[model samples]
Target: MDTITHTLFGLGIYKAINKENMSKREKQTLLFTAIGASQIPDIDVISQLWDTSGQYQMWHRGITHSLFLVPVWALLFFILNFFIFRLKSWRFFWIALLAVFIHDTSDVFNAWGTGYLEPFSNARLTFGTIPIIDFVIWFIFLLAFILSKKGSYKESSIYRISWIMIALHIIIQSIQGYALYKQYEPRYEQLALSASFLPWNYSVIGKDENTVDIIQDSLLTQKHLMYKLQSSDNSNLKKLFKQNPKAQTLYKWSPFVVVVDNEERLGIYDPRFYRKGQSFLFEFIEKTQK
Candidate 1:
């Protein structure tokens, strides 16, 4: 998910807490804990400064997002709040834990997955069931926020209801994505699904022996073939990897890639981000001698 979504989720979590008896200082500390814990995992972005190998693709959502690090982050926040807020309750630690856990787990639903298992496993676990920036989520939270302000009901009740609505939306989207993925499974040797920005819509990439099929599909209509590509036989992937280290890292980071080899160029690109005539994740090298 994007930063805005994460921050909103943090705010929602903070608002969901029952602070009827707490003082203004305690509530303020709670707000900081929720927001900070939600964003701590993204600290891995700084690794690019020291990563000369051009492996920032792998580093961005790497070990810092690991499940094992959730408690570590929570502990850090707990200690910080202890001195800064001078609050002696265990409630601060629990809220920090919830915030960090939500941050790590929410990332698994998108195409750009996180290394949730980290030291135990290096796999980038992605379901591709939801877009990185989902308008549905934003709308739900926004509506809940608006309603909560107008009502005489407790604010925590309103925010908790909003969380439930968000969960239901994710479940419905996941079910639709899984059904679409299974529909293309028998026909293709390998398949990947990327949820479109619109609800119940998906971009399905299917690869067979020598061709790749990119389909735009929705539950309401028949699948439409957007692009059909013939796999290149002349791609010397080892040479490409040697020439462009980023290509090697991309290959490792993504579930699959579309290899491009022609008279003018040799390269590979992740098909998930392929748009118009090119892909943003593409990396290539000139065929002529250096």
Candidate 2:
């Protein structure tokens, strides 16, 4: 999910684990650890450069987000943060691992989901459980996590209670995801087979539920009904094209007063920026001043 929820999740888990166990120093460490642990998996963003063929979606999330990497990364932090991390205590290790795990767990809800069981399976799972960023959760958790750290509140119950709330909130989102998923059938838009658009497995466009509208930048839009072939005969195909206004729209873009083919499907295209394979990256070469 969004970094905010991820952070809250980390904080809640920290408080839950540290219940009655935090030293003044440990308490301070726990709060910072919680903040970092939650937001860190997003370290994957750096792989945006390595997104060639969108393999980063599969490969990057595959290794770094794995269960095996947890202790390895934790150890890296433990060693690096030697002064900050009280590694002599076993509890600190447990809380640190929990913080990272919670961050990964929160990812199951976002659009750009991750591979949790990586190295085992390549499933990029998601529930579309919540908007990546929810301002209310961000605001409330922001205040709660910060206040607890700033005031150095030592109360263990407050931390436990916060974790309970976090669990309940995630459970509610889980139910919403299921209910929304069941409301309608998903119609995967069939692009013209030759669409230069590199295909992701399936691009679902039609809504499965009326109540939920997927929100992104407002520039995002989609159409449900598209021009289609009505018959196999060229005579009928030509008639159909003449009847449909959208066909005229597509033809307008072509200067080749072209011969049209009836067997082929026509499609609209969009220019999208994507990451190149790890070694190569997208760099726009500017034209000389004209």
RMSD in Å for model 1: 1.4
Residue 205 C-alpha lDDT in model 1: 89
In the predicted model 1, the residue pairs found to clash are: none
**lDDT by residue (tens digit), candidate 2, 1-290:** 66556766766666655446456777766676666766666787787685544344345445567766677666555554556664355555566677777767666554445677776765655554545565545554555666677766653455665566656765765564444344333442211110112111112223222211221111123323222222112222344344443343333322111222223432221111111311111211112312
Which ten residues in a row are the worst by lDDT in model 2?
A: 191-200
Q: Please list the residue runs of candidate 1 whose C-alpha ends up more than 4 Å from where it truly belongs after superposition.
A: none
Off by over 4 Å in 2: 12-24, 48-60, 81-86, 139-155, 185-290
Q: What is the C-alpha lDDT of each candidate?
A: 0.89, 0.47
**What pairs collide in candidate 2?**
52-276, 52-277
lDDT of 1: 0.89
Model number with the top lDDT: 1
Each model's total of backbone clashes: 0, 2
